[model samples]
Target: MLHLRVIAPAELRNPILNVLQREPGVTHIVLHPNAAVEPAGDEITADIAREAANDVVERLKSLDVQNLGAITLEVLDTVLSSAAYHAEDAADGDAADAVVWDELVARTRDESQLNVTFLLFLCIACLLAAVGVLTDSPVTVVGAMVVGPEFGPLAALAVALVRRRMSLARRASAALLIGFPVAMAVTAGATLGFEALGWVELTSTRELHGVDFIFQVGPFSFVVALLAGAAGMLSLVSAKSAALVGVFISVTTVPAAGFAVVAATMGDWDIAAQSVAQLAVNLVGITIAGVLVLAVYRRLQTAKESGGRRSAGV
Candidate 1:
């Protein structure tokens, strides 16, 4: 449900009230006319009288109410109504609007300076994967998989494509293109140093065998990537964020890249090529799947909106 508070001139109050009253899911309506404000009339206080505020926002926007001094809408979930309302109030919409675009850009930034925590997390993931390869430990491999941060750009790319935001897509792609290669190169260099120090062994591990999981790519690899990509986008759009962590673990992007680095360090050209191929397969698969899922989801949402409008005879 949504709660809406509208501060408008007393003359426009009736029209706005009429519009709000007809909106579906609106449980209450309150009017505050010519509320107290500073000389600029930029600040005015209004009381919320609606139970479902989201519905009111949609309606008010549709009505195009003139002389609307200020409009504020709040969403309320039945199970967490108080928390939801408080969250909305805390955001203040002004701050939210100011930061949303910047946040999106930051999320899609290419070659931006990463914070210490993020850099540490990435290094830790790569190091864990390196250890997993050397020790032939699938558990460690899975742990590394869960730590990878590749999914953020992937999901952002999906959102950009679905929204037809080319700049966003380009930024996201650039981040992935740059971040992955850099990570792989760093891992490769680390592996070489480890070997020189006699601290790591690349051979004698069954997991590193050419046939065990060494880049034996097929149609299935593409299919897995595609499915994982779709699931990743779903996890992002849905309220269930914890599911996204699992999705990251399920995809083999980090593992494949880690394996490629190990293979390259060992001078195993065949295994290296195969691992590279597997990495390519997964990247392409996820990108395609993400785009398709976003397209389908948008279409469904549009259809629902159209149906509602027709039902409302608007």
Candidate 2:
């Protein structure tokens, strides 16, 4: 179940209340008239079934409630009401299957931005992966994967394409373009510094071949990328952070970028080229897969809403 807190304009308060009252699986409606000091309106609260949440939010958005007021949603850990039980049972679909695009849009918008924290994590992840490659440590590579922030912009790109938001697409692209190259450049300098300090011994890369295969372009690479991308999109929309971490571990973008950086700085052009190709394959593969997954999910949502509207008419 989800709980909503709405602060609505004075004129829209009654209409908003009516909308909540009329919606199924929405219960425990409360209103405090003339309570909003800043907005000078009313404060309202409602409990909505998780399955009905997307619809309720959409309805409120259509009424322009978000434009004139604020709507906040919180997951309910415990609901004591018998009405809540029946409402949960009465919901039409599984809660986990709901996409809630508006919520997704808000989330990705914040994540896709080119911010200081984003660049910091990207650069750090790159350096860590570079260390992993130089030392041939799979553990270090996995740690770097978990640290990399590239997935946000990647997922943002997918969401932008699905939503056809050119501005967001450009922003996400800009983040990737700026973030990846900058990260590689920084790691390259770090690699040169490590070489001068005699901290790393550049080897044949054969010892790490089992793990280094991730830094090669192949059918297996594309297949893993596709699976990771799809799972990533699901994890993002569902707010499943653990699943997202798993997605990070399964992709090769960060590792390939770092490997390419170290190899190029060390004048190993063949390995550098191969790793760069691997990076490209992973990025493009995952992006295309993410776009497809989001598109399909969005279409299913549209269909479900359409079906609901038709059922209402009938």
Judged by whole-model lDDT over C-alpha atoms, candidate 2 comes out at: 0.85
lDDT tens readout by residue for model 2, 232-256: 9999877788999999999889999
Q: How many backbone clashes does candidate 1 have?
A: 4
User: Which residue runs of candidate 1 sit more than 4 Å off their true CA positions?
Assistant: 1-22, 26-119, 203-211
Separately for all candidates shown, the number of backbone clashes (residues 3 or more apart, or on different chains) is 4, 0
Number of the top TM-score candidate: 2
TM-score of 1: 0.70
Candidate 2 has a TM-score of 0.93
Give the Å shift of residue 90 in candidate 1. 26
